[model samples]
Target chain A: MYDARIMPKPAPKKHLSAKEGESAGGRVTVSIHDVASAARVSIATVSRVINNPHLVSARTAARVQEVIRKTGYAPNPFAQGLITRSSRVLGIALPDIHGEFYSELLRGADAEARSLGYHLLVSSEPRREDRGPANGSLAFGLIDGIAVMITDAASNLLKEAKGSLLPTVVLDTDLHAKGVDSLVVDNAGGTREGVNHLLASVPASSLYFVGGPEENFDAQQRASAFRAAVAASGWKPRADQVSFGDYTSEWGERWAEEHLKATGKGVFGVLAGNDEIAIGVMQAASQAGVRIPDQLRLVGFDDTRLATLIRPRLSTVRVPMAEVGAASIRLLVRRIEDREAEITCVHLPTSLVVRESSVPRA
Target chain B: MYDARIMPKPAPKKHLSAKEGESAGGRVTVSIHDVASAARVSIATVSRVINNPHLVSARTAARVQEVIRKTGYAPNPFAQGLITRSSRVLGIALPDIHGEFYSELLRGADAEARSLGYHLLVSSEPRREDRGPANGSLAFGLIDGIAVMITDAASNLLKEAKGSLLPTVVLDTDLHAKGVDSLVVDNAGGTREGVNHLLASVPASSLYFVGGPEENFDAQQRASAFRAAVAASGWKPRADQVSFGDYTSEWGERWAEEHLKATGKGVFGVLAGNDEIAIGVMQAASQAGVRIPDQLRLVGFDDTRLATLIRPRLSTVRVPMAEVGAASIRLLVRRIEDREAEITCVHLPTSLVVRESSVPRA
Candidate 1:
């Protein structure tokens, strides 16, 4: 249904065209034709100059270029693409765009993409059912390269992308395709530090691990690290000490409710999968009169801005989200430029930031 | 310089071409030739079936289409754009890509744009001096419509957009251009509610307003509303009672330091222009040994995710950021489809979310 509030009233009387010299305010833009006329050159010669400068003679091209510059004529990308085969645009597919993490990534990628003389077309990963089978490489002509940030690489979308042979760089998720490049941060390293810090303040037997989605690559890496850290601490985590979360505050809250009721005073420390869950745990703990760092200590991953904003302040793993994003674009652009370049996986580093939430209260 | 990670290594041996069937993964995609061969039709006839079905006989078209469907051949957008002049792509230009506000807006717009069968190309507003005169309207040919979320509408980019004749929608900032449409939340209403809430918790004379950047449209609207609210309360705010910020947490922190050092204890209530500034104020207040709610009452605008995450859970005016974003896309699409459509200004509603930060202690 049309959103009426945002819809403009119909005006059938006036025909609006996107062609040149028909602005609503009567402001006319100079067109290629205007440049051609002013320069006394044919439109084909003008086109040849812009797309293939070497084709035209230096003297004639110079004169045409001067007129083109003076008239401010921008060639249509579509018309240019027919000859150049380069749209000079890149596409990025993310799961969604609401989160701070995704936005920061987009910013980094966009900055890098623009500096490389490319524009970014970003979209949520479309449902497989929504895209017709024939539309597998529909973006082929419109965009030179694509960077897919889908969490689940085994999905039909990724499978289709794999077969499409598009110059693609899979972010975070490990597809391990023969030719596609992959980029990820050192999830396990940061996660290990988070667990180690928690153990330093509390016995391993008293520390719990709150894991994120099972299908998540980062979650898997983090959970593995937590297990290793726990084993290294010479403690076997009880079944009840390990909980699963979907990387959300609500899940964190829900699990916290169960954990607090079951363990009561037994669990003195927790290493959450992410900051959202840790915050949720804090909220639930506060409501239950369990003071952080006094009754309980917690550490989270992905030290997003939320880590510092919460009461008691969350100590967590800091992922350089923007840099990861920039790095992903750099990888994808290289793939686009060199189709046969050896596949490379660049793993950026992550660090731990200790805050009040994970510290013993004075 | 090209980002080293994203740049391809020297490939003297490999010649890269983006033509059909050649994939980086060496996966051969089905092309129009495959459909033509399978359907027993000439390539021109197959192209006609895909691009201009009306020109082909119904029986022949059905045969070609069935083969096309069976083979799963996706027609390229560039090849199609050459004939149809429609890319089904929309461009969104924002001041920057960072921040929860801009991200939420983008999420809304991106979701809506996709649902309407259009992809979104997002870019930061280029520096005015960086863009060539011709580049100003270059997006006109690349995208069907343009939505700019820049705060300063007087920039050269907006001026060039005003005259481009491309269907455009300006968000937040009111360009008031004859042809462009605008969509914004009730900044004044939301700001007033925040201020009124603060005054209710403390004496009107004890309250202060922290404004955002002067060049920001929302900041101006909020500041004007703050002043009006104060005037209505029968109190004239001294010059020291109103401070300006750059809509950043750091600026909020900086201004709060000045306010506290100057007023000491007289200003117990504050209405911040946005959540970032409010968060800054909270940090500064905490550092200065001022307790929230009891010693200082605060209200922030734009009820971003930061509000709930922060200590005391900031009371804020909930700007329907995602909805505003969705509305902007809907408006721009309408304008593009019907250039004769009358201009529209959609002011979405805002509500005050009262949390612990604005409530006085018992």
Candidate 2:
């Protein structure tokens, strides 16, 4: 299990032979060729015995094992992978790998993958456009399947992943493609609850919707839900009352700063697309001397850790990010194991968590 | 580039042959064997031409590539990796991956790894002991090298990683072994600055240190620095003033709640092990009607995002977590590229970010 000589120094450039048993120092090492000859079997047979022993005959496997033990022949993992055609690795492609939301999702995905005897090969690149055909080949070559979290509806990543013809699971997006499984948070339902919670405290006309990126599917669902909920309450939101921007605190702060300067004195309700945006609004409102739940009431989406840590403890829609991550892996694995399995589009439910930011203390 | 037929369904169970060119439906596909025969070159030469093109003669590589294009034969990545003995993947093993600190560190590491043409294979398991020899082999079989972040000084992860004899870089720990490079934050220097800042406002005896897990190297360093700084102020702190617990807000809250109950009404200073712990202390003190800075001034380490989100904006020590992560990969890559490179330990500096939590606003 603990062989020090498993990986010898890489052979010199001049030595172009495919054999890995030869050390750079001109030392003779036990090769798979030697094992196959000793066992009176082909090299492929020896590899199958090492990587997929169940596939080989018991008598032949025993003979190969005996020869391997006697010869001190350590099988190269790459060779084993080549014969098995299974790397036991899952590729994960996300919009970004930073922040609490992504962290929790990754944590869940990682745990599920590990439990299922698979390791995660996370794409470190953040930009979607940068991951071209080369990256698709890289993913196809390395992993059995891939789990892609598509934040932007317009992203070509989902199409590219589908094009790779590898089993795939799409996360946090509403768009559906053939031969792909999807796991999405109930964004509209959660947004409706958040809007109603805010409407209960403040007038619907004073309500504002701060959305995520325009191309984001979750953001679109949430924004649409906010409009529908407001309409049901018999109030139509003005065009100026709704805004869309990237899901960052900076964007939220900028929008709030401008809104506060324009509407200097009014009690209003805000439904931010996500927690980070809500936190930004809270910061801007605080700086402007607008007391929370007094001059401004806010509800955030994705009950991140920051929701509880903030002063007026933000009210938020709790998206089960970790559960979604785990579910994505399960779905992807199912698809990989049985390519003919029915395509699934799962929607995990979300609930609203009411806190001091939405309702003033009695 | 978007070849739909790249991966056919797996062959039937009874088809024990190592060849991947035959589909389960009995369709004949172009294989590497065909490409090699067509080009009149050895299979190994064809593989080298595809994977390590520089190692093959320009004329031979062109011939093989042309044959591959004409035959529409896509080289199996596993076969390519087997020939070159390079996966172009880096493994990352962290104690935990579900927090802001770890997220930021991963983001940095991921970015750096991508820039270096390597993807990260992050170990999903959280516990150290669960990663036995089997896990070690899995890692050794998959990645070219690894970056391990050791939180607990007592953790055998470092030892096991060393035993694997793979090129490794240890992060955020003081413990060092031969042949393994290390990258650590300047915990002591940052702690000293935090302590002196608090001492200028409050008496040294009234100061308390709420540390992370006793086994954690960073926690140990911060605690020692606190003691040294207090002693430098010509004051001896009671043993009761210092405490060690896990780096969570619950521990900070629990410790502060108990301390408040025991020593009820005077102003004091606290130096928490990390931002999470500091936020916990703040929450408990707030619930108990203790005002930050005015009643209980505090400082924390690892200026995480929570530091600013919490009320009064926590004064904290800023560990360059992202830079530390990037540096670890750089060191590991250096070691992986040059086996005989000098094993060096790098300490990135930390600084104090003073905020409203530590000083009363004028």
Candidate 3:
């Protein structure tokens, strides 16, 4: 079974005469002409053999194959890169490997990469805590592409990278780098939908929106939607409705406690940045003798694994992780395959997942 | 900010320096000396700079470095098969990219390579359906070294590979190939401890193990521990106590349902191979009206994030994913620095985390 499957292998790249603009990096760094010279074969013969070979005599093909294999010839990667300069690998550097969002993104990227037979090289924050741009040193390698999660893809690192690396696809982050792709979710739209769903069904008089990282794109986008949702509902609550933090569960719990302790508190609904913050909100609410949904129509963003696992099952706006992963890979690989392929940007869809966390607030 | 962290950087070659021994292929194809001369550097300079660089001056180092860089030089990768050759990129092939385990490992390996100014070349499964060894076609000119997962190391693609082709390290899958430094999690001990934990916590009357891939070493070891745990507790539910799968949550849920259907029975506790399987089991149990801990106890291996994310938080044996990741990088890099240092097999400790999942069966 395995042998049969191995027979029809992916054909090696043909060093065709089809011309490509020399990447400002000189052409012929390691050319097919060199392999042809050492093997003493016509360039056409080599190209013909590489692309389609039943036409060649067995003897001629074997000799060429020997030389090519012996030289460890740079054909596929080099030829592909020359044509599109897209690195087949999508480079994503994150701050920590322990997060659910990162893991989900990896899964999404994996599914997409596997469909295309590409891979991702993951590098976390450097071991030496002193290292600046922990993954900047890693960026020098050949990659057809890259995908950066905005939270992990801090602006500092993006602002200071070597010129002419892989074409990047940014996920949920602002990008200033020219010639790169950016894909952000409809953070505002999704959050607004979630809030409207809760307010339409719930009888809560006042609502609050928990926020995430101060300068975070998703956090800011979600907060804007929350403000709009509250305004549309014609409910006038205090300015203290927004509580910001790093989107940690700790922040969720702490904010809940602080709200409960504050004078004349009316916090009823919380629209959190992501699921982690939602978890903290739930835990804190539970301990503070506040019931979920009944007492607070809570909603979270990025419906990760934590959503279902939590009690009262967190209602959230599914940020479409798999979509981002698939889109990023496709955009990056296309960039690698066709240089003139205009830099592509995609806004993947998100939806509200109504579960037990937010229901008709009675 | 980026100039600083230049500090870090595996193999399969039983006869790397045996000048008199016949290579498995009976050919000494290329030598480092030839590469040095072609690049215009002295033999000692190439040796110090290439093999061990404790003795080279900075100015000569720059010139020699430029020459080697220009020549696109590398040491022989097919150690015993073809004598003299070089490819600078270190190739890593991964089974999947989505899991916490694999991502953390990639992070570890990337960290090590980046420190030593080495670039990484990565590929997903060349064939999506075929899980066999990688065809030699992907092995061409891209990498100077290789660190493989070794899941299919027993296959010909692995057996036929030249040990000297690159510096190679096998991760977790445990192929003790000659001249290859391997990093494996001590599955036997980790499983034994997990099984022992189950025995201590659950009732003696009922116990079962839901295992991973039958061919997997990690699964087999864990299964064996189940047998030992049962014997110590003087309980043998049945020889059919074991259920097989690919360590996925889907399979775990399926197996749990099937087991519940058959024999019209319920076990006191379920000891599973991984967090994925445990999740499956939990999902199945909840659907079947089986209350966790109160009605049944459960424990799983690999204290993955999913364990905590799930309700009645999984009481699992922590596999120390971060430690495994950090340690593997250090071990591989240290091996590169000094090969004679024992072919180390590291076993980062596993701890049992008792949560609501495995409360003393009420």
Candidate 4:
């Protein structure tokens, strides 16, 4: 079907036609000639919208927008080192190869991509430094754009990948890098709220902030927020109260045991790194013969499935994982169909979904 | 890079390529060309071994067998239909659209598919009848083959799909339909062993089965196995000894509560349909002021992640979910690579993994 709907295209280069065997984030050689003929718009109008959007009348813009969305078109394949066009596949590079969260996220992305007549090619890096060719390999062969979720984007491979003039979305990372749209959970906001909920019910000093992997963006934000919240409350919570560990529940248990013993059963509260750690902590506390929220308050982040399934259900910061997945595909696909489509950084909100875990000062 | 190191020209139409893709029960499709090349003999001599075994020495057949193993070539896809060429996409239709098991399975399949240079196209059917055409869409041009978890199969679409010769793997379904390859768990074996383990110290006749969705093949097999085990022990178990319920934790609680009210608070020795049901049963017993194993012993199936995470760690039948995921993809990609590979049902072994849930039955 020839699409007549249009949207404002601001890129100087508007052609995004398919080339044989293109890769992700490559220069999309597809031009406005393709969109105009496919959408029944004049090439001149396409150019006006791409290079100079204000010049196009509102009616023409709307028509173009519909056409782009309908066709599921994408403009850049240069991120994958391909100049030819292939919009059928999206490239997603995840930081961790193992984990239910990333796997589920990709499932959500795959579902949306299929619904929109597209497919996803996922790549993963075993570690931060192993992020280059291993992850960049995702760009191989006709990818319309890139969706990367890695911690250390400063690595040369990620850095080069970042500067490419391709349509891209960054997940769970900083937006300081130019020419990319980032989608991040409100780490600080969620953590701050969680700590507040715990402190409101319990009055205690020397609250523990369990930090995740040192380089992790989410973990870093959460650690800082907990400390800041405690400071704002004018609590004399010891700086030594902060303990570092991975996000695994095992770490939570180990840390809690050590902290509890050192304190000799003194008044204490804990802000765990994530749900996994939170679960471990709760279990360890239970084993150590501690009552939850009554004698000691505990809070966790990333309200994962474990939060509810565990006993004395966890009160955590709910990460909109599925929504993030859905939004990334929506944003990426929209950009693909419209070379001139606006680049947006959509920040999904997080909330403290209180269950029976943490309670007020007893 | 020249794959021509051992390259041979495509054999003529008589190459027996079509024989590779069918049921293993049928004839093996080793063509004269195949055996002749493998034996390094003339086609005329290779033909003699088949038509006139006396004319060709046994030495030649031995050589041909060696080559077959080395090349790992078999013809099953040719026998199946649409064997030689397939879309790079493989379709997996899951019964339910949610849960960690499906998530992990999808990840495993996706990982394997990626390794084999293919991508997965997943579809979720809310109900059994909703399996075909996905949300009423007319086509599945997105994928070349189908993999179903079988709850949504067993309908007209399956009958039609099989006849159409779509390379299909029907998982967890025991239906010996004409063309589909079945991959199923050893449900009966696991349950029998599990019940035996728990019942060895306690009398078998005293035990009960908390069955899953009565329609599920695994659930049915498990219930059957438990009954048979009780019977084989030379004890006639009463019909009132067992309870049937959906394979959910909520049902577990409900059924346990009902059992307590019916039996007047003293029912022991329970085997759950799955871990979820077992968990629910535990909750119910706890609420009723009955302690686990002390007052009532429980056994669960499908040692999902929840098994180890919960208190009084679940004693369950481990389904090997990750292994199944890996195996399905391995088997599937092999089929994709060679249509006429082999056609035998794969039965991955299942076992009982005991932890803290069930205690000695009295």
Candidate 5:
């Protein structure tokens, strides 16, 4: 196991005769030819041994088998696929995999795929500059279906996916593209209800909204709903009340600090983009001697584990990330199995959860 | 764009006659025979259209192109691999994906693999009862290398991995298997230092050790280190002081509650197996009106995000999960490129972080 000098030898390409189009060795990258070369036997003999051992003498077959084991050669899957049309693998395209969001989605998707007798192949946004079908072909060739999640709907990350032409499910973004199924939460409705709850419970002079990145579709939807909710309540909420952050706790803390500094009133409420942002604001509030619920009330979205774990537990709108992931697999698998199946646009519901931070102590 | 009824059509397996196998159709499943059938031409004509398009008549080529577009058919990958030796993909085998730990590891591995021009195919541990090489073959066929993470070293999950004979890097578990590389944190060192810190800083009457599952190698290492540290400090730690729990926050809470109930003294300290467990203990202590660092001091391992978010931030050992993930990829890639590379056992160093929960206030 500790052999330091052993390096994998690269197999040189074989130029086969035009008549047979078969390189003297196997027709694949890890061809039977390499095994034959190591065994000092003809490629035909090796193939005969694997396909029909009876045709080859036992002694010769045994020698070839030893060489195959030493070389670590396996038969090409494309040859086997000729008999079985399915690859039994599914692909998931993530913009990035750093956060809790994508990991939860992955867990749900992996569990579902495994239960369905399939495995998941995950890839981040492809390098758009790579150019051409080759970039998509590597993943496309291995998976029967794919699920793509892109927060920025307009990003070109989906272009290669479109080029793959495999059955696909789009998560989070409402991409109204031909033949693409979508799985999205009711972001606007959830935000609207959460905002309404905050307004009814608090007597704050103004409600400040902390929005996520401008390009994020879900963020845009939540921001729009926030404004709509304020308008419906007959409050002329100022544009200055809204600030943009990157959906991180640090960003939330920075934006909240700026909001507090600019405003003269000591009493106000905040609608954070997500739980991380809310936690950051809470941390900052504690540092600045601003009491939660008493001095500043806050609400958050995506009731992640952080929501419940934080002191003065965050009141948030819960987005069922794992369920969305499971549903995406179910939909994509159906699309793969039934070519004529109708495209699906699934909008799962979200609900507002009341907790300690957003409500005043009795 | 919202049309929901469109389904992906399955590509039927192509069965070529012996005479036609001689045609340039490629002797694999989903061969040129299927394309020729869809194009209403001979398999040779279809092959000519793809390989030597200049030689084919323009009108016939145009008709074949239209048919190919309508059928959504592409050439087989094994045939393509015959020329391109690299698949440009890596496999990551995870025990589970729900926690922040695995997610952080994935983020690091994915970032590294992408930078190295390889995509990642992720899978959970295959069902042991599946009992066949076929269960893992789908991923093995697609990836150039693999990284496996198994907390339980005794698990039979590595059996199929051995069968595939792919280059692999095992994480967390220290299995001294031949040809396989291992990446592990210094669990014993981290825990020993943490326990020593808790003992020296606080005037606690006794120290309690919270252990994770018995099967987990990391948990066992940490527990061993805790006992060693106690003996080194000339303390007669009681056998009843050691308790086992799952690496869950709830379990941590339950065990801490039991410890508190059993002890007559109000002042004590805890060495939790992980941050989650520590956080749970903190919650239980808070409910019991116990003042942190005064009534009880705590130290957790794997200083995850949860450490800083809780009130009286947790003092813990920080495991560099991302760095370990990145290193695992580098080692696996080297092994894949050089089969004779020396098996590596990388022990990443862990640091003890002092925070409010463990440090006494002024």
Candidate 6:
């Protein structure tokens, strides 16, 4: 069904009739038909060339591209999407996008999506009711698929996304909902390594698990992992040893300060939920005259940039954040391309990096 | 014209004809028409209620929304965008989005766009020649307007965005091209304050300005500001005293290492283009038995999170990156709403935050 035509070149920037290219705003909106007509190719061929160039012959794609450049023909994605039923856009919903972790993750996701001929419509903030239903339905209508990084297991976005029946890949959350792919970091394994390292020197009774918000999925996983690690090491799990707060340095500092005041003086091992908390603990412990690796051995999760920047560099679990992000996109793309594909759950491994913060029991 | 009709409530999950709601994939795709028909309103009225609810009566909007919820209608954004000639999406192109500066900027931009009922299609990586014209034309076809953060003065993204005839806002670059709004940080004023702070403590001959890439707009401005500050202080500017390199801690460390190796021993003041460079200088100088504030006073630009986390907090100029991002989106949205709006340039102020890195002469 190729309708190839050899047409003479049209004058550059010439005003076209209302139906051909002129928009309501009187701008010369060069349509895809013009590009196809000038390139001597069918409209379907032009569409395939723009979207799936590999499906079209190299010579055909090259010729079409030349015409597109010469005519400055920009195919309206809306019109193309309307006909194909594929927006060629992916929605990325993250809890927040301010930190190095999130930024690196976005960078990886964006790079992967672009390579696959998809654009990312990123939403950083949580959905607010005041913005109306348009905000909630926006992704469902516009994007082919979604990749949601769920910090909280009880996220409304997750619930809504599931209810929409769209192909989705959930990150960091362990709740394996039906018909959704999941990619999570090995929180338990990583935590066990950290706890085992700390326990080699400090007593189990002195070890404390300082975690993020109780409702957070990652935090819960890390906390549970700590308890399991302690129990595996033949130590009874104590509720008093674990404290739940925000994933912030301030919270870590406050908890450490309170613990230091209550205990008066002694060596202790602390496993912080994340690096920020570890940094906070380090700052507070330093102020309390507790020298790291001497009086207060510590290990943090998510070996972020801060792990190295902090004095007595933090020894922690290194989560492949960017890789996690990329893998999620890969999984989502597979599901989108083949809706009948088997649902898969990927658990990316996390490794422990030793630094000045946690030296052996010399 | 308003079209409203009172009809019997339709059965939920009932099969719709191919033209109405069913797709070729045999999946139930609820169209805006079905919702409009079930809600007893015209398709245009339903569109108005979803996109511009303020224009529709509240009672009618509520009733339409209730029908949408009941019928599980997700309006195809493609169809709506085709009719309105507005994607309700803004494209953001940044040189890199992995750092605190960029992430914070994106956060502000995303939040602002969401508030105005627009989504952000973000691209972080530079355009590659191998990616084909499809990658370049993607933004023009998909987004209503664009906000580009040009790290280099000669960015292809800038050139292409300018030529796309789409409403555009440029950030961090001072090209000030026709028909494009520009938003930039006050690099000159900020650098002047930093240089002046160092001048008060050290002789002009001992002061050195370590800048980023020579071709970068911000770097060029900062270097110019440094030269002016030195001249205004009645000191002859020496070309050897200033250096241009990549904006990295490694570059800063290497530069300082070579400088120290050549000039055996002397107290000097260094003004780094960014905090990473300053941090590198600190690490190298410390290793070489040189002390901050006492032996080699330093000041950095872009007071990032690392500025505070680094020991002896970095003394630097704080760029309002998030505000810049938010401002750019606001400007882009205004232009998108009124394409004939006058091109504007905004220069946001940056302030000096003196910490422990630089202390005045006794």
In order, what lDDT does every prediction score?
0.78, 0.82, 0.66, 0.68, 0.77, 0.83
TM-score of 2: 0.83
> Could you give candidate 4's per-residue lDDT for residues A1-362 as a string of tens digits?
74435645556363444432345664422445666776677877876666578998888977876666564443322321222235366767666532557656776776677678666756554344433352334443335677777565343435544544456777777563555677877888888887787777655475778878866767778878888888778875676867777878789889878877776555567888888888888888888888786666788887777787677878888887867777788888887778676556788889989877787433
Better of 3 and 4 by lDDT: 4
Candidate numbers, best lDDT first, in rank order: 6, 2, 1, 5, 4, 3
TM-score of each: 0.85, 0.83, 0.72, 0.71, 0.75, 0.86
CA error at residue A168 for candidate 5, angstroms: 3.1
TM (chain A), candidate 2: 0.79
Error of 5 at A119 (Å): 2.2
Docking class of 5: acceptable
Candidate 5 per-residue C-alpha lDDT over A97-131 given as tens digits, one digit per residue, 9 for 90 to 100: 33678788888888788778777887766444643
Q: Which has the greatest TM-score?
A: 6
Task: Give the per-residue lDDT of model 1 (tens digit) for B1-362.
Answer: 76868878556232232333455774345567667767888779999987688999999999998987776677767767877778999988887633787788888888788778788888877655665544542366788888887676455556656655678898886554554698877888887787788877677788888888787777778877888888889988777777776877888889888877766565488888888889889989999888888788889888888788667889888989889889999999999888888888888989999999989766
Worst 10 residues of 5 chain A by lDDT: A14-23
* Tens digits of per-residue lDDT for model 6, A1-362: 54436554545354353435455575567777777777888789998898799999999999999988887776787887898888889988887633888888888898788878788889884544344553573367788889888887556678767777778999887545565799999999999999999998888988999999998888898999999999889989789789899988889999999998877466789999999899889988888888998889999989887787676889999998888878888989999999988888899999999998988546
Task: Order the candidate numbers by TM-score, best to worst.
Answer: 6, 1, 2, 5, 3, 4
TM-score of 3: 0.72
- What is the C-alpha local distance difference test score of candidate 6? 0.83
Error of 4 at A239 (Å): 3.1
Query: For candidate 3, what is the lDDT?
Result: 0.66
Q: Of the candidates numbered 2 and 4, which has the greater DockQ value?
A: 2
Report the lDDT tens digits of candidate 3 across residue range A1-362: 46867688566455542133434653322456756766678777887778679878888889888877775555544444434434455566555533566656666776677667665665555544648543354443345556665554344444433233446666676452455677778887898888888776553346678888777767777877787777878876457877679777778888888876662434367788888888888887778778777677789988876687566788999987767767777777776677577765677778999999988444
Q: How displaced is residue B163 in candidate 3, in Å?
A: 8.7
lDDT of 2 by residue, B104-172 (tens): 788788878877777888874456555655454236656888888887756566676765567889898
Candidate 1 lDDT by residue in tens digits, A1-362: 77978888565332233234454675344556666656778778887888789999998899999987766677767867766667888888777433888788888888788777788888776555665554433355578878887675455545655555678888886555555688988888887788888888788888888888877667778887788888888987677667676988888888888778767565488889889889888898898888897878999888888887666889999999889889989998888888888898888999999989988866
